[model samples]
Target: MRIDTRVEINAPASLVREKLLAFSEHADWNPFFTSIELVGCDIRDSDSQVKPGDRLKVSMKDVRSGKVSTFTPTVLSCTAKKFEWRGSLIGQWFFSGIHTFEFLEKDDSQKCVLLHHETFSGIAIPLLRPLLKGTQTNFEAMNNALIEVCENGC
Candidate 1:
């Protein structure tokens, strides 16, 4: 199953990417992933730049239920255009999710579109399908908050 959400931000892709990659500032604008921490990395003095293979311990809050869940995901990619990570429960066959954030420039304009999505697969997916609708709504809220942060110079 996949949950996708997008939002157009009135800011340059560079600015959008910058704020999105700024894990340290997530608490200021992000309502979903309320906390993010780089695991076992000594670069915590400043806003650490996430790179492929980096491990992240993140706390995500469900917008509707207000339930918080923590997970350690391995970063798959972190570039100017995209950021992706994979998190799993037990093993991939049991439960896994690939979360991604893509930044698309709008025809050479300052504006950009942010695509936030998560693809879930595993034997548990069928059982978890009922909660996906709320997850999508949470993604939308996060995208809107990203727009506000990126456009307002976060």
Candidate 2:
């Protein structure tokens, strides 16, 4: 199973990426990621940032359950145009997901489009995943928040 969502923001890709990589400020505009702490760095530091191969402890709340889940995920890739990461549930056979993001420069040159997508695969995906709710809403909410923040000079 897969759930993908994306949005376009009227801002430069550099600014967008800068905001996205700002782990310390995630909770300011992102609800999905309540908090993210780098493995060996102070999350509250003003200069803290995430890079490829870094490990992160993330706390995310399940909208419906209202319960926060914590996990340590490795940074699969990070670059000016794209970013990716993978996480698992229990083990690979049970449930796993890959989140990918693309920051494309629009034809206008001054605007950018963000393509955020996630793929889920595992033997238990069909059985353990939520059926009543989907991740699309959360993704859109985050996108809107990001757009507002970036456009407002965050």
Candidate 3:
């Protein structure tokens, strides 16, 4: 299953990327990720940018069910315009996914075109499909929340 969504924000891509990469401030604007913390490294002492080796302690709340789940996923790749990461699961073959957030700049405008997508392909996908309600809605909510933060103030 794949849930891909995007939204355009009236802000520079640089600013949008900055806001997205700000892990500490996620709770204020990020609806899904209530908590995002760097693991095994202190923000004050570590580099102030996303890197492949970085690990994140994430807390995500289900938009439909109001249930919160926690997981730690390592950074797979990070660039100025894109960031991607594989999902976190104890049983890798049972459930797996990849999440990618992208910022595509408009040629003559400061608008930030953001693409947020996730793909799930695993043995448990069919069995767990019933529990995946509001997945697309959740992405839309997150994207709108991001727009608010970028357009107003992050």
Candidate 4:
């Protein structure tokens, strides 16, 4: 399934991109992500801030789960307008998903959208369908957080 979500922030695309690219820096504004416990971080040798091959180990706690889930995401691509990653549940086994963040200029303001596209394979569909609903809920919470942070200048 594909989930698309857009959020408007009272900031320019450049600033939005800056805030989003700093994956470990999410705690500053992200509500869904309680913290990003980086087990590892490696920036590419080139001028790229976050390269396609870079990997980050992060810990995310969801209010729905009420438990922290750790995963290692290998950055697929990163640019001024887009950042993409393919992630796998590091310890606990779950379905794999691709996360893409897009920064767009909307009129006088800027908008950031997160596209979460996931595929369920094998016989897990029957059980995992309900679990995927949480992603949408999480997206709503995240949009709320983004608005609050941008409004409060966090």
Once fitted onto the true fold, the runs of candidate 2 whose alpha carbons sit more than 4 angstroms away are 41-49
Q: Candidate 2's residue-wise lDDT over 5-81, tens digit each?
A: 77889999888888887878888777777887678754544422467777778887665566777888777888788
For 1-154, candidate 4 gives per-residue lDDT tens digits of 5677777676677666765556566777776766643335554443337677777666666757776777777778788778777775432145556777777766665554433333334345557677777777776786676666655666
Return the TM-score for each candidate structure.
Answer: 0.93, 0.86, 0.91, 0.76
lDDT per model, in order? 0.86, 0.77, 0.82, 0.64
Question: What residue runs in model 4 are displaced by over 4 Å at the alpha carbon?
Answer: 37-48, 89-94, 108-123
**Model 3 lDDT tens row, 76-136:** 8889888887774656688877888998998665898999998887889888787666778
lDDT of 1: 0.86
**Of 3 and 4, the candidate ranking higher by lDDT:** 3
lDDT tens digits by residue: candidate 1, 18-122: 887778888888999998888987675544377889899999999989999999999999888999999999999999999998888996868998888999999
* Weakest ten-residue segment in model 1 by summed lDDT: 41-50
| Candidate 2 positional error at 96, Å | 0.6
After TM-score superposition, the amount by which residue 5's alpha carbon in candidate 1 deviates from its true location, in angstroms, is 1.1
Q: Candidate 4 deviates by what RMSD?
A: 3.8
Check candidate 1 and list the clashing pairs. none
Q: Tell me model 3's lDDT, rounded to 2 decimals.
A: 0.82
